[model samples]
Target: MKTYNLAFKYRIYPNETQANIINVTFGCTRLVYNRFLAQRKELYETDKKSVTYNTQAKELPLLKLELPFLKEVDSIALQQSLKNLETAYKNFFQKRTAFPKFKSKRSTRKSYNTVSTSNNIRVEGNFLKLPKLGLVKIKLHRAIPQNYVIKSATISQEPNGAYYVSLLTEFQRDIKEVPSDNNIVGLDFAMSELFVSSDNQRADYPRFFRKLEAKLVKAQRELSRKVKFSQNWYKVKLKVAKIHNLIKNSRKDFLHKLSHELVTKYNAIILEDLNMKAMSGVLNFGKSVSDNGWGMFTTMLQYKSMLLGKQVIKIDKWFPSSKTCSSCGNIKDSLSLGERVYNCECGHTMDRDLNASINIREVGRSLLAY
Candidate 1:
């Protein structure tokens, strides 16, 4: 059986009173999770072989009853975090790793997670009543699968003072066979262009930050002119936050969609697993910003493949993807990043990136573990 996590974010219309309550709820959940984590640790250290999720969950009903302020927007979520802590301990005991820490309250944004009892977050008309919070008006856009059980629903605040909910769901399914188009592809992620597939397809990288750089600078300037914690400072900070979030959202969306397109259209994708951080270290900081999107691209490709039923074969970082000959398998000693054309003395010539991509694809076909 396979599990798929589907998350959707919808903007919410919340008045000041609702916003205040939401903030408090966020604080309350964080505090509860942290307090429980501390107690769990003490119990385990003081000679108890184990503390299960059941113990942590038993506290929630009483906490809710005592506080009465914590709206059950998500009861399952509170316990699920505790369960996750148990899983962390199991991993630590078996694998000898670091223990999990408490959740932080104020960093960027925090979420209150809830389990969907009906596998659906029913919105009666335009208003939806969450567990502890009364009616919250949200502009519902799309409908999700009701058969799939909702594991968690996370409520977060956008930079523009807008609230949104992300629903995480899972369904049991049989193993799926991905459709093969008899298409083998190689990917060369580079600085100038985003990527060149083994099939010689080039995608343009949309540099979002470059487009909004001026606006961000202006927002920062406005923020600097205002006193910290003042109304104006908060307003300016929100503007800056909005720009940053937009850039992040845009980049993630682009990568996710591109990965979906490649996995759906082709089979047997091969890519060079370069050390992006190490590569960036050699270049000056500013020079790396416009081009370092390979990490995001590769992550999307790998995780998305699990759902799409495809394989992403990663060639070693040291592999000479550009200098190596696809025809004769002769490895060249050195290749310059600026050189766009790859010419081998063996009389093989191709676009530098395309040549690299072919080498990666051929490697995947011949030596992949399969």
Candidate 2:
């Protein structure tokens, strides 16, 4: 049995008092993280020294003595914030991400992470027990496995004032690999339809953001006309946030359902490993690329396939899947983006994405033979 971690998120309804406490915790965690990050930067610049999580964590007690309000919130959340800073620094040094930036007070999303200790975090019917805030009402939409053990919980408040808790749990399971060359399919990324499958099926993605763009623009126009920080302005801001949330939720739901369908139908799924960031920024296809949620779909396919003992294969990004003929394997000198239909001198003509998907599947099959 191998151990795995999974996160289950649930909507939480806290009393006014508990809500205040949660908000306070978020502020305290952010404050601690920013404080330590600034200190680390100053120390490294002045004395050529670095601060570790342990060094900063040991000072929390002294900080509480100086700022006393820090003692009112969960202590573990503060430590977790420091740990997050450490992680950020590690990622920066490893060239995996840019340097960490200071947390802004006006940020829309507010969150803090807390660990479970001594049964401090648990679910009881319709309530969840959390650190410092006890027995907040939770909407348990799905049942958790009996063997899963709660590890940590992340509490977050969305822009629309909805509170959610994502519980990280650990469990063990045995997964055996299922190898099959017959049940395989390839997918080519599509800007408008999401993807084209080897079997000539399109995802037929409904561009959620595009559909709601006009509504969002009108809402923002009204928000702009209102006085900033006024009651009316706040109300309009909430309306705008709700619209954005609707788009995000709709897109996520579609991707989840489509990924589930693909995983269920294929044993081995192949795709081209396209750099979505480059495609969005360098290629100037930001809006269309972001609306499709291709990156999220690929991630879902990978994890779901692994759990089901299936496969997800990605060919090289530089492969000339589009410029090469799928029938005769003739490589063309060049193929323009406007050419939606692929044509070769060998008398093969097909839709461009379908041809690319076929090439991806053949390449994946060859790789599997090795």
What lDDT score goes with residue 132 in model 1? 54
lDDT of 1 by residue, 25-126 (tens): 677767677777788778879977566777668877787787776543455556655666777778887986787777776457767776666534555678
**Candidate 2 structure quality by residue, lDDT tens digits, 21-122:** 999998899999999999999999999998899989999899999999999999999999999999999999999999999998789999999999998999
lDDT of 2 at 124: 95
Clashing pairs in 1: 71-132, 72-132, 74-114, 186-198
Where is model 2 more than 4 Å wrong at Cα? none
lDDT of 2 at 307: 85
Error of 1 at 350 (Å): 2.8
Q: Candidate 2 — what's its lDDT?
A: 0.94
Off by over 4 Å in 1: 1-3, 15-18, 37-77, 81-105, 118-120, 123-129, 173-176, 179-181, 282-292, 302-308, 367-370
Q: Would you estimate the TM-scores of all the predictions?
A: 0.80, 0.97
TM-score of 1: 0.80
Candidate 2, residue 44: CA error in Å? 2.0
